[model samples]
Target: MISADTTPPLTAVDKGRVTLLYHFVRLQMPAVKVSEPTFLTHLDRTFRIFIPKAPGPVSWAAYLEGLYAVDWLVCVGCLTGQNGAWEVLFNARTGRSDCLLVDALRARAVRLYPRDEERQDTAVTEFWGNLIAPDSAGTLPVLARYDGQRPLAPWLIRVFQNWHLSKLRQSGGTTALPDDEIALPMDTPRADGADRWHETFIAAAREWLGSLTDDERLLLGLRWRYRLSQREAAKLFDLNEGTLTRRTDKLRDRALEHIGGKLVAEGWAGDDLEGFVLTELGSLLTDDPRLSADHLGRLLAARGKSLPAG
Candidate 1:
């Protein structure tokens, strides 16, 4: 129904499906009195924003799953992350997901008062407030620009750093460099390098996984480790496939960036980090004892949650 070739808004089948879904959603959310036409208009805008241009969905139900997730968020008024979507989706064990991003960027505030704990705390608070504060146009600030294309964490890292850098320059502080300034370091070869690299990557991966909420952890395990398709993931989460695609795109991207960034910080060459993630991450997700589907299944079963029936 959303293909490039088809110019009519939605096919008759999609329109009918949307009407039925709207009624189903409204039954639970009686307070929202959005008219059908208005709802269709909103869904059109949603498709344009999130779906962009994928070959139309293979199934109607699959495509609509994302819409349901997004709409439910809209109705409940929690769709936006005070830090944005990150707050809702990621449970970074270090703290809340939004706080995690702000803390990471707080270091880049360019004006650091290192010794005084009170000052440091205030600076962190200020940086966070500014990161998500609305602009003069009333649009959300920095974090709202995420488009789900790049690896989430790294993209965030670059975006936050660049923004901080820009803010610093405007304030007449130090000259902040852009992303190229954080150049990828070169790799050095060694016989035991692969083994050591795998060990380090796995350690970081497990720590990162432990930081997530159980649901987020399982979602990743299902998508990456178990190789669930977007449709299957939608069923498991009770979301639309289009919506899962958007969320999982960010989820997977953010996770890999964390894993890769740890390796790079430990002195693996930029090339090695990219190479290992591209070539080896799948195996690690699928075969590692920690991330294996069977292990996660047992964990879920222990929690009394069952996978959706096929």
Candidate 2:
């Protein structure tokens, strides 16, 4: 449900944050850098994640592949290193107080104060005491707020960045994330990159899937809705495993082509559309309720199996 509202356009503060993040990552390595215009384009996609219906609680998607559509991937990577931080954030067997995510964030804090050991230690101390501390009810509010609608690693990275951003600002510092030589850039973001595009990605998905044939729809339903394996699904349709594989692959491509074309008609350019399909398309289709997988069971009465409860 990609709901719409009269929510005002991106504010100066939003642009400022994006500009800062864009410069933050580009300053690192060239190989990991995304162009400023491309970053701004994806920024719009990121803001849509928070469907802020006025005064109502923001409805967000489950966090299977959040970073899939997000910009500032390299910057995010810089904050959360590849240490299976995703698992540590919500692993049933792991503890939250001193997890891999915390360590990665601690490393980010270290980057903020590379030459100053005392400040680094103090920053890490404050982070643990404030964010990781359990409340009187014996629950960590920061970790508890995670609803699995977005990746915990990036969510925690934003939380960590905001913490430091506020701290530095409150301490009378002018920089967003202060370093000995680096600071977040201050510049306006270009909001017109994707002309006339107003988050119809989900709507397009619903229409595309709705147009599929019964058999075609059920093929997707078996995998996404019923959570059936390829062998099981193939057996259901009485097709060989190899033939089932090719058909599913074609369906995946067709979805991309259809969605990509819709966006292009809405003023998305070649590279911009490609950027989304390659990087962010996974987020929407991964666990979407309307478009891809969530409710297909209700539509599959022909299967004769008891439909799953809502």
Cα lDDT listed for each candidate = 0.53, 0.52
Candidate 1 residue pairs in backbone clash: 65-240, 66-240, 66-243, 81-84
Error of 2 at 301 (Å): 18
Off by over 4 Å in 1: 1-8, 16-39, 51-162, 165-310
lDDT of 2 by residue, 1-310 (tens): 3354322354576556556656654654344445577665544444443444223433222222222222234323223332333233333121123345555565567665667788877876775555435535765445433333344454565566666766766888543333322121122232774324435666677667667886787787677645678898887777899999999998888887998888877766556565566444444444443433323443554665434343
Total clashes for model 2: 5
**TM-scores of the models, in the order given:** 0.35, 0.41
lDDT of residue 260 for candidate 2: 83
After superposing candidate 2 on the true structure, give the runs of residues whose Cα lies further than 4 Å from its correct spot: 1-99, 110-120, 132-144, 148-154, 165-241, 283-310
Error of 1 at 139 (Å): 6.6
Model 2 has an lDDT value of 0.52
